[model samples]
Target: MKTQIFYFSSTGNSLCVARDIGNAIGGEVELIAIPGALKAPRPVTASAIGIVFPVYMWGLPALVRRFVEQLQIPASTYVFAVATCGGNAAGTLAQLRTLLEKKGILLALGEVIRMPGNYTPMYGAESERSQKKRFAKEKIAIRRIAPLIADRKAGKVDCGTWLGRRLLSGFVYNGGMKQVPASDVKFRSTEPCNGCGLCVKVCPVGNIVLVEGHPRWQHHCEQCMACLQWCPQVAIEFGGRTQGRRRYHHPECSASDFVW
Candidate 1:
């Protein structure tokens, strides 16, 4: 059966998981980038459609949320969603199911993969040793769950219990979104920036634009961190707050890499 993997990633954690699943299944991987970005629609007729993304502020990333609301999926397609999170996925899976079901699509399965915490303000800098441990755990979890999705398993995918949802929602949305100081969201640039414009080219939301030979964020960012994380020269930084911070992306992925 033909399968397509769709995803939106910031720090590349979600992208890594999406790529691994696509490689394991030997399926075509498609990127469901944000609106106004370069992307090809998934051919969903009689095929398996997989969505992999990160949970932001207890919900989908603003861009991913908009993408799903506007997405037109085939009625007969088999749908599955996988979320990568530092801790909890919040209500992402349930929200995705509700949206897709309205379009007459059925959710076959859902999985959550844990990765290094990238929400800098909230999680801080996890040690390389800790990140290694988390990645190893996630690899095992992905292996266990990958086959279940490939087999087309049908069952209620439990992300967590009701209490878990409530707690996670409070932490991700209230603690991370509402309460986090704006100063924490600031970013910086390093000397490596050659002003190549790749960040502008790859930004799905047009959040970054080249200004005077350097990329400048116009305040109305989705906080997807795509520009900061995907800079080819490692030039983008989160201002003084993230200065000297360790940058991360998927091991084999790069700034100009396109999944589809």
Candidate 2:
């Protein structure tokens, strides 16, 4: 059976999960970057489809939600999802189930995978020692999750702690969503930026461009922080909060791994 894994990752946590799942499924599999996928319209169908992405503000990333809404998927396809997050899954999978339900499609398996996080607004990047522990556990999770997906399991997948957090998550998530587009206004590069234009290249939404030897954010930002996390010179910062703090990208993933 053919499998198409559609993923969105700012720092590669979700990409790592998507890649692992693909390898474990062990058949014809292709990984598609969600941002790049949205650019060129085409028919997308497979025996199975996986939606793997990070949850933001306890919900779906802006672009990932749009992809789920617009993707041309068939009702019969075995649809599975893995939401990679720092702590809580919190109705993120439920939100996905709702979207698929609207199209008369079923989300066969929805699982949450915890990983090292990179949301700078909330805190500093995690330590290398801590990230290694998470990676080890993540491997074990993929080992267990792959067969269920391969066997085409059908049901809602949730962490025991996730159920209670949804009410609060939903409230904060909805309110936070409104600020996503203009949130980029808070990001500015420091003197270290030398017009490398790498930020422009790494921005998932193409929300950045170079003007006078510096990267500028357009209002359509996904708040993925790709430019900041991937910047080689460490020049990018979010409203001064990220200054002199660590940046994180999955150790297993590189700047070239993402398509856009």
Candidate 3:
């Protein structure tokens, strides 16, 4: 079946997973970057459709949620979703199922793949040992998931309590989403900034601009941390927390891979 995979990734973790799945499941696998697709979501008539993105605050990213909400999926198309996360997925799949149901799309598959954590505002990158462990697990999970997707498997998997999902969705996830728009203001470029304007180009939301040859945020941030994580000189910081912390991008993905 022809497959169209829609993916959003800041540090390239989700992007790598999407590509791996496409490679395994033979066909005309089209990988569409969610940020670019969000600009003009046209109807998709693929034999199968997939959405892959990172879990944010135990739920979907604000932009990812909106993209699914607005996406036009044909009723007959088989649909699946994969949530790549550092920790528990909580209600991410449940949240996505609800959104897709509203559009008359039954989510045929919902699963999570654990990956190294990159929520730098909260913590530093994982240690090399920890990351290696996670990546190994991720590869196994993808290998199993890709065939299921290729065969059009229908299933759902969720690992969280009803009460826990409610609390996280209502408090943590929702509150975290509110912070996304203003969070860009917290980003600061240190002395290492070279006016290269890479941040402006790397931002998925077009939220960064050059002011006096340094990057300035437009307050419409998605909190993906692309600009900060991909900065060549290790210059970008989120408030006082990320100045000296290690940055991480999926080792399997490169800057050119993210340009889509």
Best by lDDT: 2
| Residue 167, candidate 2: alpha-carbon lDDT | 65
lDDT of 1 at 143: 86
User: Can you give the TM-score per candidate against the true fold?
Assistant: 0.80, 0.95, 0.96
RMSD of each: 3.7, 1.5, 1.4
lDDT of candidate 3 over 1-260, digit per residue (tens): 68999999989889888988899889889989998898877458688999999998889998898898888767788998889998888888888888888889889988799898888988889888988888888789888788889999887666467865788865788877887798788888889899988888888888988999899999998888889888899999998888779999888887666654
Positional deviation of residue 9's Cα in model 1 after best superposition, in angstroms? 1.3
Q: How many residue pairs clash in all the candidates, one count each?
A: 5, 0, 0
RMSD in angstroms, candidate 3?
Answer: 1.4
Instruction: Compute the lDDT of residue 24 as modeled in candidate 1.
Output: 73
Which residue pairs does candidate 2 place in steric collision? none
Q: Candidate 1: misplaced stretches above 4 Å? A: 26-43, 123-125, 164-185, 188-194, 232-240, 258-260
Candidate 1 — worst ten consecutive residues by lDDT sum? 176-185
- Candidate 2's C-alpha runs over 4 A off are 159-166
In TM-score terms, candidate 3 sits at 0.96
Error of 2 at 112 (Å): 0.5
Error of 1 at 27 (Å): 5.8
TM-score of 1: 0.80
Task: Give candidate 1's error at residue 20 in angstroms.
Answer: 1.5
Evaluate model 2: give its TM-score.
0.95
What would the per-residue lDDT of candidate 2 be over residues 73-180, giving only the tens digit for each residue? 777889999999998778888888888899898888888888987888668888889999999999999998888888887756663345435564577888889999
